[model samples]
Target: MSEFIQEKRQYPRKSLEKTAEVLDNDTGLSLGILEDVSKGGFSILTDQGMRPSETRNVTLVLPGPQGSPHKVSLTAECIWCQTITERADFAAGFALRSIEDQDEVALNYYIRDYQVAGQKAGELEES
Candidate 1:
């Protein structure tokens, strides 16, 4: 028998697996991948590990429906970091600290768009 872990999140998360840039708000040099995102926070996969409570600026470059590019930036604080077993990669969870209104709109739209697309795909698969 297999057991699955239950999620305990306030908002639904969308898997992105998209490249993202993480910048240290103070030094302006950080890098990672935007693994998943929710309205309140996101998980980043990186080669480096971060300590809990550390903060950084995350910027996601999402492609628009018309192929144009959209960028959303937000301030986030690291909540937890765990190393991937047998790999050099680490996955870190972050809580959004601050986001401008425009950015928030963009982020919400991006997440909802992906969620809808994913649902449609699932429906197609089940059909």
Candidate 2:
């Protein structure tokens, strides 16, 4: 029998029209691509494994207004991680810990406009 897990999210996650790439700010390494996002947290599909409770400074490359690429920098804490592929690809969940006011605004705009429910993955609306 499968064990049931309760959903503890404060905000509902939304699927992105286009996946955003997440990078480690300190190392300039590509951590992963964002799979789903919410106001509180997000999940990424990555090749790197992260331990729960680990913290990192990250930059999210988001699709901006007028087709420009906007980068939002923030600190995040890992909530959970699981290996998802035979080649050791992992899916990790992270909670946003800190963000600048301007970056928060940009993130909110990206979540609102770029992530619409029922939109097919990688299908972005024309600007």
Candidate 3:
């Protein structure tokens, strides 16, 4: 049985259109690109049929916000996976798998920025 783990912070991330591969245990099955990201979770858009309630090993290679490509590999299980018939994109939301210490630091910084910006925006909205 696989254990579910969540991160401390949820980052607000942008859409990353890069090649991403999803692995089940030690076997490679399908590939997709990361759609949107956050520290707590992320959504992937893929045409392949992957079970949501199962654990998976995912490796995502994307260009970081600085415009350099960075690879992040982690173990994640699909909390919710669905196929969108009305829309062209299918989304799969997964918990943070296992966020590494280094990645957590980066994610914390990103999440902090996201929270600050959101707070500022909310304040502005009231104005």
Instruction: Please say which candidate is ahead in TM-score: 2 or 3.
Output: 2
TM-score of each candidate? 0.76, 0.84, 0.58
Candidate 1 regions exceeding 4 Å error are: 1-6, 17-25, 85-88, 115-127
lDDT of each residue in 5-104, candidate 2, tens digit only:
8889887777666767999999998999988787788999999889999998999987777778899999999999998975339999999999999999
The TM-score of predicted model 1 comes to: 0.76
Between 2 and 3, whose lDDT is larger?
A: 2
**Model-by-model lDDT, in order?**
0.74, 0.84, 0.58
- 1-127 per-residue lDDT for model 3 (tens digits): 6596664434445443344344443665455556666666667777766677777776655445656645566777788877886533567877777967876676545433332223443332110
TM-score for candidate 3 = 0.58
Q: Could you tell me the lDDT of residue 57 within candidate 2? A: 98
TM-score-sorted candidate list, best first: 2, 1, 3
Question: Residue 78 in candidate 2 has what lDDT?
Answer: 100
RMSD of each predicted structure: 4.3, 4.6, 8.4
- How far in Å is the alpha carbon of 67 misplaced in model 1? 3.5
